[model samples]
Every structure is written in structure tokens, then in C-alpha cells.
Target: MAVIITNRSLADGIYMMEVAWEGVVSPGQFFMVRAWETDPLLSRPISVHDYQDGVVTFLYQVVGKGTAILSGMEPKNTIQLEGPYGNGFPAVDTPLVAVGGGIGIAPLYYACRKFKEDNPKKKLRVYLGFSNEAYRVEAFDAIADEVVVDVGGIIVGQVDVKRGETFITCGPRVMMDALCQVVPEKNPVYVSLEARMACGMGACLGCSIKTAEGNKKVCKDGPVFPREVLEG
Candidate 1:
């Protein structure tokens, strides 16, 4: 269906939005967004970072040919959106702690919002680690009670807290590795990995990550997996 481009912004080089589309979108799902008339490379997948009524917001990085084409679009323009795809982060209880590195912050954005909506009394803390201090997103303070690091070098810093809070992660390998080491055990932490997806559906097998259960497609089984399922 056509999602009206109500608003758009350049998040460094990435594009963020406030789009109004018909229908209900799941809290942690994504839609394949692109100007249909100007189809460049099939479809570019972007996740629904947050939503309120018909207005669904996606925070996407305008990287590569597909995303670059999306960034140039204008308001009132019709963009094709296919989903609410893959498995989103599991909803949680207890205090919420979310961490993302670089553009991986996209899913974490929605996850945190969902957490707060479900549990109003719980405290929310976010740590957005970027490739460098320059690439670090500047808006963490708005959503999180605490914004941890905004620097270069190591994207994942040590996380210290009780063993019962919920955690979510999305970013690079080294960064996730660092986080996996630190997050408390059995705390309901989920990780979103950046892998190639030829088809958002499971047929193509482009984005697969091994889990404790079996070989799972990131496009199918995840983008978000329980921390215990990850190999570390």
C-alpha cells in the first residue's frame, strides 16, 4: 500500500521519518520502503522503529544504491511498503536497557519505546555506541533516562546492573561480542544482526545466523534473537 511521506530527515547520511500509512503495524516490524515508480533494486528493507495509529516511523540509514534512492524522495510521494516483517524483539518487563551501534540503533529505537509503553514505572536506559564519536546519534537523551557512551574506538562498553532486567542489541559482530560478554544471564536480551537479505522472506537464505536451535535466517528467525541462542 502507499504510505504518505509525512516527514523525513537526514540522520547524518541516513533518513529518519514520520510516515502515515493505513493499517496497524506491529511494534517491532519492518516494511520494504521505496518509491514504486522508481524501483532501483527490487526493494530496500527498513524496519518500523515506532508507530502511533496510522503514522509509522522508520529510522533508516541512506547507504548503498537502494537507500540513497530513498533519501532523495519527497513528501506526499507514494512509497511502497510490504511488511511488518521478521520476528521483532520480545516484549519485556523489569527495567529496560537497550544498546545499539551505528545504524543498528534502528530496531532498538522501537524496542525501547515498546518497553516504556508496556511498563510505565520501569526505568529505561539506552547506550548508543557508534563506529566513532562522529557517527554517534545525538538524540539518545530524548528517549532514554540515561545515555551512556557517544565516542569512538570501542562501541560496546561494560554494562553493570542486576541480572533481571531486559536488554536488546543490534550492530556489528565485535560490538555484539563485547555486549554478550557483559549482559547479565537469563535477562531477556535480544540481538539484531546486520546480514544480507536477498529476500525478506526465508526463501533466499541471504541473511542466516546459526542459533542454538538450528541454522536460522536472520530475515526469518530474527534480526532479533534471544541472547542465549547466540554463539557469542
Candidate 2:
């Protein structure tokens, strides 16, 4: 269990939650969270938005009962948090391009920081998509070389896919599919998937999906997978 340091609404139904946890975490990893004991039955999975000096933040949308309860939680409230689970985005020396849609921006923020920290001279580009109003864009200014936000239109379209580039994205499956349509096969692309998880672990088989490789568990084997693995 971790203690909530702050919980505030960021946008209409969106929230940013901060908790005191000192464990090592990687970009694109997630945690199973819950403030209640049994009413919701299963914990909700939230991605790591940002982490620094023993504090971790999560950005989420209150789309249902579990998240609503989480959003209502006050500072100092203790919550159950299960992990920094799943494989994280890869660290590469090549120029990094991160594309995120809506709440999917949560993990990419961490990825951007990781990239900048590893290679200070490297160029980093971030593309964010929101249905209308935008959020957390200013946060990118500190770490990214370039940041572009698309409101009301697809952010994927703004991406200039080129040969030998490396791209990473997370968002709705439809948006991800659209991105795959235009991206060149020669580019190394990674994607984080969203799924409803019952156990938050691989044992339940609830988040299983077929890939070109075979069926894999999103809670354990991924949430992050190479685009080639899914396509090939």
C-alpha cells in the first residue's frame, strides 16, 4: 500500500494522482490500483505518468466505477498498488518519436524523460492527440526537443514517418491501427496496448490476445510490444 500525496482533476473527467513510492520503475510500465477493498472486485490498471525522487504520478480518466472512486480519494488516503509491471519501452540511441493519444500520453511522458536522460544531445519529438482540449503539454517542454499537439484531429497523421526512424505509441486500438497503416515497415515501432485485466497478472488469462507470434498476456508479457511482433 502507498499513501496518496495529491489527487487533482486535470481536465473534465481526467485526474493526476501522486503517491509516495521509491521503487524503481520503467517507462511504459503499469500498476494495478484500488482504493476500495471489494466493491469493484478487481483493481484498475494505471500507467506510470512520471516518477521522481521517490514520488510517482499516474494520469487517468474516470470512465467507470473504479476510477470514479479513485478520483474521489483525498490526499493521505492509502491505496493498494500492485506493480511496475509489463515490459517497458526500449531504450535506444536513435532519435525518439513518441506519439500518444489522450490518456495514452501517461507513459510516453516517462519515455521522453528516459530518452533525454540517456542521450542529452539526441533529438526527441513528441506528438500528442486529444479529442478537443489538451493537457500536460507544457510538461513536454522541459524534456523534448519538439512537441506537437493535435486537437480534434488525429495526431498520427502529423507524424512524418521515415525509414530508419524509431517510433513508440500508446492509445486506443483504432488510433494505433491507423498509425500502423502509414508507418514504414523499416522503422522500428513499439506500442503499448490497453486491456481490461481481471488479475493484473498473467494467471487469469483475461487479457490474452493473439499476436503473429502467438497468444500473449498483456499484464505480464506486454502492454508494450514491437510493432513488428504484432504485424509479423
Candidate 3:
């Protein structure tokens, strides 16, 4: 069990929850968090916003009953946590272009931190899009070499997509689909997907999505997948 350190609202319904954790967790990995006991039987998968100093942070939007409960949780309250599950973004030596929409920016923030730690000289460009005002802009700006924000327009169109560039992104399906269409065929792109999940483990066939390869489990196979296989 992880103890909640802080749970504060960052935006309208979006909350940032910091918990005391001990283990190494990668950027795109997530934890199945539950603040209630039996009321909302299953836990919610929340992406790692940042992890440092034995504290792991998660950015969540309070859209449902489970999240609403999480939002109301106070400091020192212990919550059930399952894992730092799912495959994270690959460590790339090539320049990285991270594009995120709304809450999708959660994972990218940590990914950028890892990239900068691995290769400080390499370029790390971050592009974040929001339907209205942006949250955590200062946070992204701290780790990224360059930061771009789009409030009302298509942020995908602003991406230059240099040849052989690597992109790591996550967002609403429509936004991801649009960005995938814009990315060059030769360029490599990785995306973190979201789905309704009953169990964080693979036992339940809950988080499955059809891809060109076959039906893939988001909870096991990946919350992160290559763009080619997903788009194909």
C-alpha cells in the first residue's frame, strides 16, 4: 500500500496525487490505484506523472466515481496500489519529439525527464495541446529543450516531423489518430493507449484492442505500442 502525500487540483477537475512509493518505475508505466474499499470494486490505471525522491506522482482527471473519490483523498491516507505496470517508452539516442493532448501530457513529462537525464545534449521537443487553457505548462517547460502549446488549433500540424525523428505521444484516440497520420512513414512513433480495465494483470480480458498484428492487451501487451502496428 502506498500512502498519499498530497492530492491537489491542478486544473478544473484534474488532480495531482503524490504518493510514497519505493521501487523504480519508468515513465509510461502506471499503477492501479484505489482509494475506496469495495465500493468501486476495481482500481483505476493512472500514468506516472513524475517519480523522484521515493515519491511517485500521478496526474488524474476526476471524470468518474473512482476518480472523484481519489480527488477527495487527503494526505497520509493509504491507498491500494498494484504496480508500475506496462511497457514504458524506449530510451532513444535520437532527438525526441513528444506530443500530448490534455491529460495525455502526464507520461510525456516523465519521459522527457528520463531523456534529458540520459542525453542532456540531445534535443527534446515537447508539444502539448489543450481544448482550452493548459495545465502544467511550467512543468513541461522545466525538462524540455523546447516547448510548444496549442490552445484551440490542431497541434499536430505544428509538428515538423524531421526525417528519422522519434515521437512519443499519448492523447484522446482522435488526437492520436490525427497525429499518426501526420507523422512520416519512416519516422518511428510510440503511443500510450488508454482503455477501460477490470484487472491490471492479464487474467481478465478487459483491456484488449484490435491491431494489425492481432488483438493486443493494453494491460499486458502494452499501454505503449508502435505507431506502425497500431495504424496498420
Candidate 4:
């Protein structure tokens, strides 16, 4: 169990919650979070927005009953956090480009920060898309060589896919598909997918997805996957 350090609003229906966590969390991993013990039967999988010191942050939108409950909770409330699960974005030595849309931007912040820390000399660019209001777009300025924001339009068009550049993206399926269509098959493109999960663990087989390699569970095998695997 983790204690909520802060629960505040970022924009309408969007929230940033900080929890006291001492465990190691990778940039693209997530936690199955639940604030109530009994009311909601399942925990919501929330991507790690950022982690610093002893706090793990979650940037989420109140999209359903579970998230609505989470948004209503106050500081000091105890919540269950089941993991730092699944494969995270791999460390890359090449110039990196990260693209996110709406709430999918949650995981890219930490991923970009870590990449910059490890590869200070390499170029890092970020593009964020929002249907309406934009938040935290300025935060990328510190870590990215370039940052671009698009409101109410496709953000992927701004990306200049260069050879030898590694691209990682999480967004609406349509946006990701469009990006993939433009990227050469030889370039490495990683995608983070979203699905409803009954159990964060693989035992339940609740979040299985069809891939090139038969079937894989999102909670166990990935929430992040190579673009090629998805294509096949």
C-alpha cells in the first residue's frame, strides 16, 4: 500500500497524483492502482508519469468509475499499488524521438528524462498532441532538443523521421498507425498499447493481445512492444 502525497488537478478531468513509493519503477512501466479496498473490484493501470526522490507520479484522466473515484480521493489516503510491471522502453544510443497523444503522454516524460541523462550528446525530440487543452508541454523543454505541441490536430505530422533515429510513441490507435505508415520499416519504432485488464498479472490472461508471436499478455509481456510485432 502507498500513501497519496498529493492529488491535484492539471486540467479539466485530468489529474496528477503523487504516491509514496520506495520501489524501483522503470519509465514505461505501470501500477495497478486502487484507492478503495472493496467498492471497485479491479484496479486501474496507471502509467508512471514521473518518479523522483521517493515519489511516483501518475498523470491520468478521469475517464471512468475507477478513475473518478481516484480523482475524488484526498491526500494521505492509502491506495494499493500492485506493480512497476511489464517491459519498459529499452535504452537506446541513437537519436530519440518520442510522441504522445492526450493522456498517453504520461510515460514519455520519464523515458525522455532517462534517455537524456544517459545520452546527453544525442538529439532528443518530443511531440505531444491534445484534443483540447494542453498541459505540461513546457516540461519537455528542459529535456528535449525540440518540443512541439499540437492542439485539436494530429501531432505526428510534425515528426521528421530520420534514419538512425529511434521512435517511441503512445497515443490513440489512429495516430500511431499514421506515424507507422510514414516511418520506414527499417527504423525502430516502439509503441505502448492500452487495454482493459482484469488482473495486472499474467495469470488471469485478461489482457491478451494478438501479435506476430501468437498471443501475449499486455500486463506481463508488454504494454510496450516493437512496431514490427504489432504489424505481423
User: Judged by lDDT, which candidate is best?
Assistant: 4
lDDT of 1 at 149: 72
Q: Ten consecutive residues with minimal summed lDDT in candidate 1?
A: 131-140
Q: lDDT scores for all predictions?
A: 0.72, 0.90, 0.90, 0.91
lDDT of 4 by residue, 1-232 (tens): 7999999999999999999999798989999999876867888999999998999999999999899999998899999998988888999999999999999999999999999999999999999999999998888898999999999988988888889999999989899988999889878999998888978888899899999888999888889999988885
Could you tell me every candidate's TM-score relative to the true structure?
0.88, 0.97, 0.98, 0.97
On residues 1-232, what C-alpha lDDT tens digit does candidate 3 reach at each position? Answer: 8899999998889899999999999889999998888988888999999999999999999889999999999999999888988898888999999999999999888998989989899988999999877899998888888899999888898987887679999998888888889987788899999989988787798998999899999978888999876866
- A best-first ranking of the candidates according to their TM-score comes to 3, 4, 2, 1
Model 1 per-residue lDDT tens digits across residues 1-232: 5656654665467677667777766555677676756446568778777787778877778678887766777777667777767888877778888878877777777677767778878888887766543332455566677777766656465466566788788877778877888765676777877677766888888777777777888777876778778763
- So what's the TM-score on candidate 1? 0.88
Which sections of candidate 3 miss by over 4 Å? none
Task: Show where candidate 4 strays beyond 4 Å.
Answer: none
RMSD in angstroms between candidate 2 and the native structure over all alpha carbons = 1.1
